[model samples]
Structure formats: C-alpha cells, structure tokens
Target: MISTHLRLSALSLAMLAATPFAHAQTQTPRQSGDGAYLLETVEVQSSADASRDGLSQPFAGGQVAEGGQVGILGTQAVMDTPYSFTSYTELLIEDQQAASVGEILLNDPAVRVARGFGNYQQVYIVRGLPVFSDDMTYNGLYGLLPRQYLSSSFIERVQVFRGANTFLKGAAPGGSGLGGAVNVVPKRAPNDPMTQLTVGGQTGGHGHAAADIARRTDDGRFGIRLNAARRSGDMAIEGESSALSMAHIGVDYRGDALRVSADLGYQDHRVDGGQPNITIDGGVPIPDAPDATKSIGQSWTYSDSEDLFGTLRAEYDFASNVTGWAAFGARTSDESSIFANPTVTNVNGDYTASRFDTAREDTVVTGETGVRVRFDTGGIDHTVSLSGSVYDLESKNAYAFGAPAFSGNIYSPAPVALAPNTVPGGNLSDPGRTIHTYFQSVALADQLKMLDERLLVTLGVRYQRLKDYNYDYNTGNRDTNFSYDEDALTPTVGILYKLTPTVSMYANYIEGLQKGARAGNTAANVGQTLDPYETKQSELGVKYDGGRLGGSVAVYRSRKPVAGQDANNIFKIVDHQKNTGLELMAYGQITPTMTVLGGISFLDADVDGDKAIGAPETQANVNLEYRVPQWQDVTFDGRVIYTSSQYADAGNQQKVDAWTRLDLGARYLVPLANGTLLTLRGRVENVTGEDYWASSGGYPNAGYLTVGAPRTLLLSATFDF
Candidate 1:
C-alpha cells in the first residue's frame, strides 16, 4: 500500500527555508484622475480596452502596469471591453517563471488546461471553452498555430477577453475569440538604453538564460527591443527533459498621430517527455515510485520542434479622433516525435511497442487593415471600428512506425520488427495539403452617455463572412478534404451606471457563432455544415475603486441555443453545452508595501442540460506579496490554489477528487557599485506534494489518467544594466 502522506522533496525544502529572507520591493505609483494612485506593477483585473494603447492600465483588482498592457501585439482593456476579460504583463510572467501562455493561465481560476501535443504548445480551456488562434495575426495580421510549437519568450504581455467580442474581431470562430481571444502584445522601442541578463538553475541540472536590450526616445515615440532566452536541462520528472532557444526583435514608432511596429522572432525546443498518468487501485490514487515509474498504457517519449514567426504593423491617425492601420504576419513550425507506450499490456501480459515516430508541419500567413473613427453625437461620444482580413494555412501530419504487437491488443507490449518502415504502399505524403480561409467583418458601434457621464450605454453590430477552401490537393487521393462557407451577424450591447466616481456597475449581452463544414457519420448519414453554432452570453458585474485598492465581481452565463452531442455525455463535435459562472477578483497595493492579486470562480457547464463531464464547479487563486521597507527591494510571495472535485469520465463513475496546493516564492534585489541590479528569486511548487489526477480515460472501455506535476524547485537570477 502506498503511503498517503508524501514528504516534501529537497527542492521544496530549500524554497521553504529561503522564502522568509527574500527582499521585496514596492511598485511605483502613477496617479489616476480620480484622486487615486495606480500601482505600476502587474496587470490582473482591469478594464480591457484595446483603444487604450493595448497596455495594462490599473483599474480594478490590481494595477495594470504599463509594461504589462500593450506589447508588440495588441491590447485588451477590461472596462473598455464588452466581455469578461483579464491580462498579465511581462513582469508578472517573469516573476512566475511561466514558459508559455498555458503555464500562465493555470493561475486563473476561470481557465482550464487542455492537453498539449507538446510542452511548447498552448491548449487553454477558458470557462470550459477552447481557444485557438486562427488567421495568423502577429502584429495585427496572421499568426502561427500551437502545433507549430511556439514559445512566449518574445511576448511582452498577454490579454484575454472572455465571452464573444466577434464584433471587434472578424471570423472570431476560427480564432482565440471563441470563448475569448488571447492577444500577445510584443515589445516595442525602449526610451532608455537598457539591457538585462538572467540565469537560473532548477532541479535536474536545468539551466536557463534570458537577455534583453532596448532603446527609446524620451518622448516615447521611437524605440528598438530585442529579447532572447535559452534553456537546457533534465526536467524534474525522470524521462522528461529538453533544450530550447528563442529570440525576438522589434522596432517601433509611436506619436500623437502615427504608430508603426515590426517584430521578428523564432523558437526551437528539443524535448523528451511523456504524458504523466496515475494508476488508482480501488479508491486510492497510486503514487510514483522513487525510480519514477507511472501507470501502464502511459507514454514515455522524446520530441523535437522548431518554430518561426514575424509580424509588421503600421498605423496612422488621420484626425484627432480617427485612425487607420494595416498589418501582415507569417509563421511556421516543424515538429517530430518518437515515443514508447508504457501503459499498454497484451493478453499474454507483455508490454507494448518500443517506439514510434510522428511529425507535423504547419504554416500560416495573414494580412489585415482597419480603421477607427470617433465622433460626438448629442453630447455623447461614439466610436466605430471596421476591419477585414485574409488568411492561409498549410498543415501536414504523418507517421511511420516499426514495431509489432504482442497480441491482438493495441496497448500490449510488442517487440521490435525486423525493419522500421512506412506501411507498404502507404500514402506518406497524402497529409500534405493547403487550407485557405478568407474573412471579412464590418462593425459599427456607439457609446451614449448621460447624467454627467455617470450613465453609459454601448451598442454595436457586426457582419462577417468566412470561406474555407482546400487548395493544392489531389481530391481523389485525399483521405480528408475540408471546405466551407458561412456568415454571421453578431450584436453586442452593454450599460453602465456609475454609483460614484469610484464605483460603477455594468451589464452586457452578446452573441457568438461558429460556421463551417461539418464532418460526422462518415458519409453514412453525414450532415452538411450544421446550423452555425450560436452562443448567447450575458453578464452583470460591478467595479469598485478606492485610492489604494480596487476590484470587480461578476456573474455570467453563456448558452448554446442548439448543439450536437453523443450518448457518452462528453463535449465533442456533436455534443451541445451550456456554461455559467461567477467570478470575483481583486488586486492592488493594500498598503505602500503590500501587493495582492487573487480571485475565485464558480462554474457550471451542462451538456444537453446535464452536468458536463470534467467541468469542475469551483476554482480559485490567491497570490499575496509583501515588500517590507526594512528589507528594501526584497519581496515575499505566496499563492494558494484550489479546485473542486469533478467527474473524470462521461459516465461520472471515474472522478477526480478536489485538491489544493500552496506555493511560496521570493525575490531579493542587490545593487552593484556600477548601479547594476541583481535580482535573485526562488519558488517551491506543490509544497504538499498532493497526488491528484488531471484527466480521465478516453475512448473504448480502457482507463487512462493524467497526474499533476509533482513538487519542484526553481532558482534564478537577473542582472539589469
């Protein structure tokens, strides 16, 4: 029998001991108009409005640090936005040592993690919704896909808008705007000649480096930014490790009327990791042995991937209240993998294949142009924006294997075959194909104000057309041919009433839809692109702001008027779903020396009016930091996260119990004689080392499991020049 009480690892012990002595620094405060000082630190809860230069501006929950708002990409403001939204800045990203968007989102209670094809990719589940960025829009145009295996090293900030804002973005269905969209703002010109270098070592001899240099004019008009990171080491878990390199360069010009920016970046990762699944005997969850072995049918594999992407954007303001812009972007990825199946067992009680190989190649290109016009109408300000774009994608997936099954069972251990080769006469190149999708959108919006600007009303409508074409493929020889044409007209409305200069309440109703060709029944009872997916969402929330603290709370419900579903009761292409949630978040400086960002969320998702499988009912995050004046420049941070129990399978028989985790981190700032600053930080994850499952079994009657990352420690240092 496995012991339920797991001891903390050596790494965890080190972090726990050092955390109490770390230095904490208070953030600089910038004044807001209403007798308030905005803490310039992190972007947590704030009005997400793109019109505001796309940078984080402190409002509710926490300070929207300027650096955390707009980067090389774009901006999303919470208040200026029509839906539920949040964002994180580069400083926050650095503090958490998050490697990708997926890592960052795990801190958000409302967001969930979807399976990733590779460690470098992102598979975010927001409010039970999946986010995919289609139409490569790097600087405002086309971007790359996750399968291309990109990293966040070059990203300056990340923004997310929950619910539908399709009116603001065309072809919202194909992009991250589905439940919401994530915009990675790139880095721009720095005002001063600045340079930074970071070096770190974690468990398993892991080492990492990050370097950045920037220069900008005092007037905040022109600048250049360059950043890069390289990491290599064995991962905390045995059989899991890798090496990676990434770089990003950007040049920008910004003024009262004109702004232009361009960014070029690339990332490559050589990985050797497998899915970590747990085995449960009876009602007790199994634990990994000291030698690092997991459940059967599990995977232990190695993968390598390289990604490249770049973007160019130009914007001009024709008038004081009007502006227009054009942008273009290109991205590509090459991924290859080899792996062994650990969980599989044959009828004769033998293991599965020794190894197999797979590869994916994908590319995306995008172009776009848009204009924003603002005018006064009857004492109210009205803003209207219109945009259009064209995007193309080429994706190829192929596999070759050399192994034999021990028996009829696919999961059974099998010995190597005499030769490793593609199946005889297999169409190895058949997966190579091109997909071209064209999208156009036009939006008209107006904001009406009354009662001395205390009462606000906003209304807008958008018309969109989407066309997907399968080009450059031999139709007769193709195993999969995808083509589609669809259009949608979405509407958005919102109202806000200011109880006072420091408090306000707002409500919004919006609509979302996804249209494309459908694939089901495999030609037997196939259905033509079913009616476009329709999601109607409504939210009511309030904002509160004081001199030193601010935050917001909201409850929302989004329903798909009609959906497709299967009998198993899980959400799939045919499964219909309804999701509702309540969210509360707060962030700010409780005092000159204390900063906090935290939130809690309760969610309910039903498929066909029944509880959706794997949809947890509650989740929360609480991150607190204190900067003591005595320790000047030192900070101590602690985070508490909790997730309620949820079903693991469609039948609900397999369930993942509720779990909570504690993490402690700290940073110390040391000043060098040359005015250079050295920042040292360390973190302990999963202080309790809780053994929990993340995912359940898939397909057939066989069982599978997903395990949470075990306790690990990381230490790093950064030098500023």
Candidate 2:
C-alpha cells in the first residue's frame, strides 16, 4: 500500500508552488474640499460571494440555480458569469428520487447519459462531445469520484458547466472533457439540525434504505453530517440483480476568520446478468429494440467496483478583501469484473461473444491552493486570483480475453457456458502498474468591473505541465523505456454586459488542453505516443430574470482534435471535430402554483469530412410541476424529452431512430408534531413503455448502442426529524 504520508507531501508541494500575479493601480481616491472624500472605498470581502458557496438559494422553481462553481474563480452568480451553466440542488435530487448522477442529468437539453464501452461506467455527452466519468471533478479537484457509478445520495449538488473549461478548471486528468465539465458538491450541515430516514423500492422488487443525519453546534461554528445508503435485489431486467452500498461523512468549521471542511465517502457497487451494449458490423441495418427488460447476458457475467475517497479544504481570511485557501483530496479504487458483451454480425442482432476478465487499481492525489484579492485602480474594480494545482494518478490494470466463441440473438437468446480465458494480459487477481499521470498547472486571473459595475471582463491564463508513463503489464518496467512530457499555456477571456437591471449579455473565448492518444495494440505504430493538443470554444449569450421567471439564449462553437491513422497507417492528431449549436432554456415559477423547467438545443457537427456520431441535430426537454391550490403539500410533475435521429457510425451509414420519452411524478409532505416531517415521492419513467435505442457509443470514438430503459417505477418515503 502507498504511504498516506506521500499524499500529504504532494499537497504541501502544490500549496507552496508559486504562480504569477498581476495588477495595476490606476484609480486613487482624491481629497475634496471641506474634508469630504471624492470617492468612498468599496470593500470586497474575501469570503467570496455567499451564493458561490452552495446551491442553497433556488432561482424560482427549485429545479436549478443562478450560480455554481466556476473553476478557480470559485462560485460566481450565473448572471455575472460569461459561461452557460446550471447547478441542481439537493432538493431536486431527493424529489426526483434520482439513483445516480446519470439519472439526474436527464433533465438537461444539451446533455445525454449512456453506458461505458463494455462496463457499467456512466458516460456523459455534453455539447456533442463525450465527458467520461473519470474526468468529472469532486468539488474543484480531479480524479476522486468513482469511475463507474456515483450515487446521488453522496452529493449535495450537481454543477454542470457547458463549454471548454481547461483554462478555468485545468485540463482533466483523464485527458477528456473537451466539451464541458461536471462537479459534485458534497453535503454540508445546515444551520438547523436535520435528520432524515428514507425507504424506497423500484420495479423488479429492488429495495433501498438510506439515512441522512446532521448536527451543528449551538454556535453554528462547528458541524458534522453522516449519510448512508444500501440498495439490493432484482432490477427491471429479467434475471438481473444488482447491489450498491454507500456511506459519507462531512465535517466543517466556521470561525471568525477561517473556514475548514472535510468529507469522506465510500461506495461499493455490483451488477449481475445485466444486458450490455451490442456492437454492429459491416454497415448492417440497425435492428429494432426488443423487450427492454430482456437480458441476453450470461448468468456468470458480473462486475464489482469499490472506491474510498476524502477531501479536506480550508480558507483563511486575512482581511475583508484578501483570502487564502488550500484543499487536498485523494482516492483509492479497486475493481474486478467478468464481461461478455457481444458483437452483432447481422441485421437481426445475431452476435458472437467471448469471455473477458479484468482487474484494476487506482491511487490518486490532488490539491489546490490560491489567494483572492480585490482592489480598485482609478474607477475600475478588480478581483485578482492566483492559484496552483496538481493532479497525480497511478493506475494498475490487467485483462484476459477469449476470442468470440459463442453466438446469440438480441431479440431472442440464451446464455451459454463461459469460455476459458486463453489470453491473460496479466494476473487478473492482482494487476501490476500499467500507467501513471502527473499533471500540474498554475493559473492567474483578474475580474475587472467597469462602467459602474455594469460591465465585467475576466482575463485568465493557465500554464500546465502534463506527463504520462506507461509500464508493461507483467513487469513494472516502462512500456517503451520512455515517458511522455508536454506543456501548454491556455488562456480565457470573458465579458458580461448588463443591458438592463434584470438582463445581461455575455461572451467568452477559451481553450482546453488534452493529453495525446496512444496507438493501440492493433495499430501498426502500437506503443507510439502522439503530441498533445487543445480544444477551442467561443460563445455568446443573453439572460433575463423576471423575478419568478428566468431564461437564457446562447450560441456557441467548439472544436476538438482526436486521433486517426494516415494513409500510410501512421497515427497522428490530424483528425478533428467541430460542433456549433444554439440553446434556449427557461426555468422559474410562472405562477404561484405552477413551475416549469425546459430547454431546446440544436447542433451541427462534423468529424474530419463526415458527420459526427452521437450528436443528434436536435434535442428538447420540458418539465412542469403544479401544486394544488387546495392542498398546499401536494405536488405533481411531468417531463418529456425528444432526441433527433443520430448516426450509429461516423460514416453516417447506420442511424438510430429519433426517440422521445415521458415521465410523471408526484410528491407530498406532511408536517408532524415536535419538528418532525414526512415526505412521500413517486415517479414513473417511459410511462408508455417506449422501447428504442437510446444512444450510440459512450466511450470516446466508438459506436455501440444501448437500449432505452423500459417502464420503470420508483417510490420513496422519507421522515425528517
């Protein structure tokens, strides 16, 4: 086991790392006659915007908020930010009975959730590009959350920032996220003591039990919270079963000039006899989806994953306009799995499968430290920030594969005996070191407010150093006796102009850096490393706030360079993708008893000279909730989503049909004696039992279809005391 002391060393090194900071004092208060001052001092508190702390304040309908974490800028108001983003509060997570982060993102118009290549890892597609779960950040740090599954209960808020953010958040350690970024804010104890116990069940007799307990000192300066959940039993799929266990503890300290917080979490999840994606071959026509609940996977197929992670963060305010903060986080993950996902060879879903066993271990350490200073030069106000961060990850992996040795059909199939693993990549029981990634960056930014605070301009830059090392599976020696090292300077510029007291216009231009891709075992230049590259984005948008009603309209363009082989079978970064899109969204209370949240998005994308896969030309989502006037505690909600036809291949030869799904939900709250409250919630997805292919490919640059989920019921009751 790696020594815990080493983690602390990394944190210390990063905290002490120096980053350049710049400022110019142009404004100076002048003395006036009669001892009167010409300009009064406007102090900017170091505590940051209170709204930036968490998604505590609802914009209107309680579905989403007006602000969220914006990389190193900490939290900024949505109206004040130049980027398009949304933060889903804990209330929404509970009200919807969302099982995981993937489920909660269904309400987003610009986002789609799908399964990983051959495993159960949740993958997110934002703005026509893929953001792997591994790229997601916990708080503001990277490489901490579970790679495959992240439970909804373990997080307090889901913050989705659309557009390339490498300049703001630093390049993702996973080398992905060219489209956007996702961050989960851990729960914190509220001012009042809160304790909630919940009982839930879903279709297929799946049972769940969870608890949330929180307590704060009388002075509100010290607080702690504990949460735990367990889910098990058969799922909606026939003969399929799954189990998930999770626990989290949060502690915080709020002092006069200092704030400290710590969070610890553990998750263990497993799935057995669940259907996997089907890969098509030879430009075969896509086949109709069968019973969504039917499972053609072998009974022996199973996956197991467990992760333990924690983060400690604190901030000290030297003065009202100066604050310093440092944070450290780490994660240890382990996994073992046996998979037999099949490949479809015919138009009828007929396929061949083989056994594949794998094991993996990962250790990650991440840290960040920064100071924020606000001052005025001449008549202009500036908030200057200097920060440094480091993300270090070491991964050990092993795999054993058996060539396609069995045949089955997607419409009607039977499981066969498991084939012997003939090709052992290494010891699946205990894998050796496979890869290590060390990424470090220093950033500086200044938010300048001019025009009497009506116009805001943000200028920032990040200097990043990326290094990757690969080792042989059996022997720990370097794969090719060499390591990969590269660096880049990413810059960002954003502007927000207030057209009116309640309306604003914003635009931003940014760049994102990603590590280079490597040649696979089958490539002619296998083991060769290509140079890293960057993605670019430009956006313009306008927002309006009408008290209880709010909405925004945005247009953006982005481009990312991937990998492709040349005519000579040499791999390079010549392949690239460009996407342009428009988004219109609204969320707020339209009336005293009614609230709505929805959006429509359209995109045009191309990879090289062909259409991009997975990015539908159009998508839309709408959700409305109503509270009965006669019954104050009763509420009803419904949602509908539409996705346009999407190609199953980059060539655009095969396509998945356009599909739409509907969901309905209801909830009630009952006040009891002595500060006790009871809440009941229920939801049904795909109310009409629609069956279709939902997405093609979740892993980067791949085409695999995952069938849409069948009609599913989720019901839960919670008692808060």
Candidate 3:
C-alpha cells in the first residue's frame, strides 16, 4: 500500500520532471472576471482534442491527467487531457422536465438506450460498445454497479465519457465493459436555503409528490441537503402499476484551505413487471397485443432495495505551492426480487389456476479512495493521481414449490392476464442457493504540460483481482471457487496547437481494457475466463470559440471487442470489434435572447461484427431555446432527433428502420403578491406523434419496441418562498 506521504512526494517529483518541457509550450490567453481563477473552464479545439482555461484553480497532484473540462460531481475542472466526453447540467434536466434518466438521455445522439423490463430499466450503448451496469463510474470513480431497476428522481445530472478508459478507471468485475462508462452526479448541498414541494400526476393515473430541502453558509464553506419522493400509479401499459419511495441526505464543507463532504441515501420499490410486451398479426408494435392479451394474464412481481452510502473528502494546500486532495466512500445495497407466475386459463379454456414463485436476493458492498496533487514546474504545469478500491457481492435465488406453471404461451395476450384475483405470491428466499464474489483494484497515473502550455502527455496503469464462489441449487452443495488477477498499462497522447486566440485543432490516441469471469458454464468452458479485452480509439477534431457560440466536430475510429464468444459459444478476447464515426456539438447563444445546444453522432460500428447488433450507423439531434426579450421572462424550447436503421434482434433476423421525432415546450415566470416568484411550464412531447423504435427486438420476439410516448401534455406551476 502506498502511504499518503509517499503519494504527495511522488506528485512533487512528477512536477519537477515536467518542468523542463513546460518552457517549450507557448502561453495561451487568459480571461478576467469575478472569481475567474476558481471557475474551471474547458474549450474543445476539435472533435477529439481540447484546451484548458489557464486561469482555473490549481488541481491536486496524482489526479488522472485530463484534457479540456473535467466534470466530476457536477463541478467543472479544466484539464488538457485527451478524451471525448460530455456533461449535462441540472438546468438542462429541469428545462426538459425529464421524468427519468432514460427520458433525459433520449436527446443525446451519441447514446443508445436498450429497453429492459419495458422502459423502467435500461442500459446505454456508446460508440458501438456495450456499457453494462457494472461499468458505471461516479465522480471519476466506481459507484453502484448492480443492475439498477429504479427511478432517477434524485440525480442531478449525468456525465458520458466515450472511447477506451482503461487507465482512468480500473477493470469491470463482471467482464462486461464493451463500450465506455457513464458517471452519475447526484445533487450536492446547496449554497442557499431552499424548500421545494411538488405534486403531479401522469396521464396513466400515476401521481407523485417530491420535497427538497437545502441550506448553505454564506461563504460557501458549509452546506446540507435532503431530498425525498414517492409515487404510485398505473403504468402506460394495461394491467401494469407501481409504487416507489426514495430519500437522500448529504453534508459538505468547502473552504480556501480545506474541504470535506459526505452523502447518504435509501430506497424502497414495488412494481408489476407486467407481462412481456409483444405484437401479433404483424401489426404496429403496440402494448396489450395478443401475447400479453392471451398468455396467462400479466404476472405481478415486487422488488425492495435498502441502501446506505457515505463519502469523505479532505484537501490541503502545502507551502510548496502544491495542493493535495483525498476522497473515500463506502456503499452497501441489499435487494430482493419476487416473481409470480399464475395460470390464467386451463388448456380447455376453463378458468383454472396454478401459481409458481421465485425470489432473488443480492447484496453488494464497495469502498474506494483516490488522491491527487498538482503544482507549477518552472513555467509549465504537472499533475498526478493514485487510486485503489475493493468491492464484494453475493446473490442468491430460490425456486418455490411446484416450478410455477411455465405453461402459458407468451404470444397469447389473453391467456396470461392476471391483474384480478392475482395468485398469492410467496418470497422464496433461499439461504442455501447463493453466489459470492470479491474484487480489488489499484490505479496510478501521471500527466505533464510543456511547450509554453501547447502540448500535454499522460500515462497510466491499473491492476485488478477477482474471486467468485457458488452454491448448487438442487444438491445444496458448494462449488469450488474462482479467482483471476490481471494488470494493464494504458497510454494517452495528444497535441493542441493554438491556431488563434479562439480556435484550436487537435488529435488523440487512447487505450482501455475490460476483463470477464467464468461461471455457470459447462465442463468444456468451466474454470475458463476470457482474456482481458482492449480497445483503442483515435480521433481528429476541431473546436472554435465564437465568443457567444462554442462548437466542435471530431472524426474517430474505435476498435472492436478484444475477446468474446463465437457461434460455438467459446470465449476469446482477440475478436476485436471496430467502429468509425463523426460527431459534432454546439452550445451557447445564437442571438441575444436565444440559446441553442445541440449535437449529432454518425457511426459505422459494425466492421467485423453483426451490423444489426451494434450502434446505428448514423444519428443526429438539434435543440433550440429562446427567451423572449420583449417579455423578459418567457422561454420556448424545442428539439428533433433522428437515427439510422439498426438490428432488431440478436439473431439479426429483423432490422429496425430509421426514425425521427419532435418535441416542444415553454416556461413563464411571473411575480406573485407575496414577493415570491411563480413559474409556469408546459410541454407537448411527440408533437408529431411519429412512432419509432428506440431499440432492437429479440428474436423469437420480432419487431422493435416503438418510441413516441403517445402525445403527452405536461403542465406545472412552481412558487419559491
């Protein structure tokens, strides 16, 4: 283990090493304004390269070296590291009145959402890569990695980092990191006292209530925040309903000399998983079709989750003009899911009954710590960071008496309907049927600046260790354990030339890796783990600053999976997947009162693999918002999205065709008699009501799930006290 003192010493030495090159890079321009040095700023020079604001506050040593603006926990940090990334702000989410994280991501052209359990649970696809649950990162570190089947009422925003990230983060314990990672940034303590309450209902008879409370010291030195929400409603689909509750609390301290913070949360949820939705007679992909209409009436299931989490952060400024920051967090989650299968109609069409029950319990615990330091070297800058983490999980599933009647055809919608007189379900919690797993990882990185601040280079390495244990279901016997250990060295290099004070063109090369484990396998593949997977991405892009308008465009090529399963089900890491694409994003004010933010992503991710199963070959988005200058407080927002055709099933039997949709919304602010400001907002989603497919369909199950939330009208009013 590396001590904190050693970590600090190493940062100092790294800076000294970078000093020689610092003098060679030319100096960039600087801005002057209030607290300018403390506001981290980033500017994309091109699609693949970026430049950092020189006036930003100094960063800690040992932090993963970065390029452009680094977004962690909602705060922006300026770095010149080489990577393509994007950030969504809380204002953006609020403006969209997004009901869930999935809803918010619909506007991002680079992200592809995969439907799981209807639209309640989903995963993201990036640049032709599969970013599963375990591949999640928060504040630049690993957070919850379980398959999350929950809402996003409390999250503030999300950060999406594309391409290979082997050195920035460690390895994926589940061995499922085919794409990149998404970091969720929860709401932080507020800087002012506030209390907000909301009550709303949806078109589907779903209603919700939410409350938020926050307080902060005047100097921004200390703050506390609390959030709670509850909802109960019938789902958009027939015979589906849900109930959920969640709460969060956090405390934070930030000062010129030192900083510390902590956070905690818990949630309880129950939902009707509703029968698998499917279409019949080759009709539109509508819910309540023949399968759902015929199969044993829709089944009902419930899941409960109890979670506790906390994090501590400390920072110190040394006399050497260098600063060091360390952060550590721990989280634990206990979850249980109960499934009920009921007989809707007997073979003779007589209404008879049978019920089968199964339950699964999963427990996860994790701990992580990271430290970094930074200081000026002669006339250049240097930064370095080190981090380590440990994670453990245990899952158990039990089947109750009479292997619940698996007799109904999922295609028969009427046969499976079970909303009324739902068969009584039991929690088959099996203490004997379980799987235990453990993982540990360590990472170190260094970055240097030189050539009058025109060029920067970064190098990083990570080590991973994993162990798994399983218990037999039938015999109630334990199986031999599994263990794997591996290490990887990743390098990132880029160059940025100051073409002008407001424009720069740059390019970069970065590498990342993923590892997988072997479990629940046959004798032929038992005790087998696939080789570590690696991906390398190369990008060339440019960014320009037009004072009020900022935009960037990049062209990139990403390699395919390093190893994977073939038609015979054998595992290998050498089967690399490949994707080449172009992306463009623009943000800022187009006119005095008109602000526009939009982006487009075009890609061909299927060079060696099945084209139907990967990301769409092309996608685009455009959003416009304008605040009326005459009215001063009225705003209008609108957007349109489009994507190319993609595969509809794993077997590639059917292909999903290209599609598009449009949305419009508006907000008005007015003064009230009590000195409080009243805000009114409304939105008409799917203005065109164009039906489209957001994801591919599973074979056996043909036809993609349709997009377009019908025509939804949302009206809300807010009063601030």
Q: Judging by TM-score against the true structure, name the best candidate.
A: 2
Quote the positional error of residue 135 for candidate 3 in Å.
3.7
Q: lDDT value for candidate 3?
A: 0.54
Whole-model lDDT, model 2: 0.82
RMSD of each: 9.2, 10.8, 10.6
Scanning candidate 3 in windows of ten residues, the lowest lDDT window is 46-55
What is candidate 2's lDDT per residue for 24-66, written digit by digit as tens? 1111233345322233322211221121243335577667866
User: What lDDT is reached at residue 81 by model 2?
Assistant: 92
Q: If scored against the real structure, what TM-score would every candidate get?
A: 0.81, 0.91, 0.77
- Cα-based lDDT at residue 42, candidate 2: 28
Cα lDDT, model 2, residue 338? 90
Best by lDDT: 2
Candidate 3 local lDDT, 120-210, one digit each (tens): 3456667766565445654444545335543566565466676666556655555444456676655655433556666666546777777
Q: What is the per-residue lDDT of model 1 for residues 1-721, given as tens digits with 9 covering 90 to 100?
A: 1112213222222221111111112223343564222333321211111223534443322323322321111353344333566666656666777777766766677766544322223445566665553321343443553443446676655665566556555554353444555666676533335678889987667789998787655444566778899999876655567788988888776555666777778788876665433223333332222122222222345677788877777778788877787778777887776654433232232323434566667777777777777787777766666666666666665666655532222222223333355442222445455455566666666666667777777777777777665543333243334567777788888888888876778899887666643545644335445455667788999876675676688888887643334465322355546788888877677876787777888888776555555567888988887765666456788888887876644445556677788888998876555645577899988777776555333211223445566677889987775
Poorest 10 consecutive residues of model 2 by lDDT?
Answer: 15-24
> What local lDDT score does residue 677 receive in model 3, on the 0 to 100 scale?
47
**What stretches of model 2 exceed 4 Å from their correct place?**
1-56, 519-528
